[model samples]
Target: MTAIATVTHVDLATVQDGGRRGLAGIGVPISGAWHRSRYLVATNLVRGAEDPRQPAVELLAGSMELHFHLPTTVAVVGPAQVTVDGLPFGAGVGLAVTADVRVVVDHRGPGPVYLAIAGWEAPLVLGSAATDTFSGIAGTSLRSGVALTGVAGSGCSAGAFLRQGDDAGGPLRVVPCEDVPLPVGPWRVQSTARSGTRMVGGAASSSGSRPSRPVVVGAIQAAPSGELIILGPDGGLTGGYPIVGVVCSADLPRVSELEPGEEISLQPMDVPAAMQAFAVAERERRVVHPGVLGRDGSRRGSVPDDVAPAK
Candidate 1:
């Protein structure tokens, strides 16, 4: 086995404005050149009052500094502060590390405070790295200097880990999960008109200009009006709602790229056609980036080619 490096320093810095901010304003900043390292040592309580449930951890937003021990890639999912060897860096940005690095997250607002270290090993149950905070199965909440492991065999050494640009804003795509029946086209999304719109395990209610109602996909279900909640990889095994449509597994990445108030259009697709589309998309993804190719070679964004719009 390769020699594992231990965390040298950790800090619970306050988040300032305009670091590495993400949707709902959460994230962190990374600095310095680190190599052959592992682990994101969280040393502070990073909090996000705006989104208390989906607190900003591991992600960066403001002038925070983080140190690393090896060549690593950092992805910011929420807003945070960042620093490198005591120097300030830009917010909402992803950093590639090639040597020992230091990061600081200065808290700006009242949100959950946590730090995420890269290059650790954790068991994989689903297709995602996020720990089921509720189930306590894969991951748990972060504390000061907490060293949470990463996905084993990830081999994510040097490359762009962020799917969307730091400032890239656009619509979110949704096909329905295993519950929905029909292949829905893209739909527009916006933040909840009012606050107190609870997000159960990252499951937020969809609003504004959604796809046709009553989308059905195998075991998933959806309601006609009110709110449409799409299940993510960490979603529960079964539910009660009538899943009207299902987002193809291949298109989940597209959904992740969506920001609030963005428009998404969905094209209907059947089971057989959906499967074929997935296969084609996978091939295309590999061709675009051969290094990231996995054994499965499955695609993770957009609808498959075979799936056509409902006439």
Candidate 2:
């Protein structure tokens, strides 16, 4: 068996994956990767698919570094420069490594970077490997000098959709709304927490704490002050805030990537339109880089067994 890498320095990082599902009725937060699509795509890039339950290192808005301990490939998600052995590398791409190689994360870029190994073998709890920051379910946030292990395997590969560039299109599209006022222009990210990303300059027609109510991943609740707070990966199973509108599943990636102080917008959309957008996004991602997860959310092939260190 081959050892993967050892964590040298970490800045507010944790292990995260697809997230827990189905326990919301009993009140369990769906603590997963902030950007689900990015996580899935990144994992699939390195492993040809995402296990959904496979854990990956989730880095926040700070610096983190590691030392590659074996021969394998890895992926780095989001906008951050990856330096291998003192050389600058691309973001949203994979890199090859051997024993004793140094990999550093230049967190100066717009972040929430995800670091995933080839054969993810992190410990799982409640059917997920994602770290529940709110409840500390699977495990606590990662600290410096810890060694993260992955299943040893043979071979190395690259992803098809390893394209370089950012997609700065129009405002993100959201589902149709009722009495809730349109977030007219760019709204700034006032702050981010495990529960949600609070936006400034929006008004909530009605606001007040109520009994904890069931909430899904992208529920956008409005405060009496009109400020909008979109649920994060660690969103509570029940919330007391009044939900004004819901963000479409297709735009969840960009929504989760919202950094504090950054400005963005949301446009109105319908159910059918939203579904179509999601379908299109999936197809595009696969077309660029074929993956293991399909429409039914099943893997194309059997998952490889985790290998132990060579005897």
Q: What lDDT does each candidate get?
A: 0.33, 0.69
Relative to the true structure, candidate 1 reaches a TM of 0.44
Q: Deviation in angstroms for 166 in model 2?
A: 4.5
Q: Write down the TM-score of every candidate.
A: 0.44, 0.84
Off by more than 4 A, model 2: 1-3, 160-166, 177-186, 207-212, 287-311
Question: What's model 2's TM-score?
Answer: 0.84
For model 1, residues 1-311, the per-residue Cα lDDT tens digits are 22112334333322111111131111111111010010111211111111112212332123334445554444332334455566553332334445566655564422222333334442332322344322444332333444434432333331112212222233222344443334333444543111111112223233233433332212233433534455433233444555545656445433433445555455556667667856765443211111232223333344344421110
How well does candidate 2 match the true structure, expressed as C-alpha RMSD?
A: 7.9
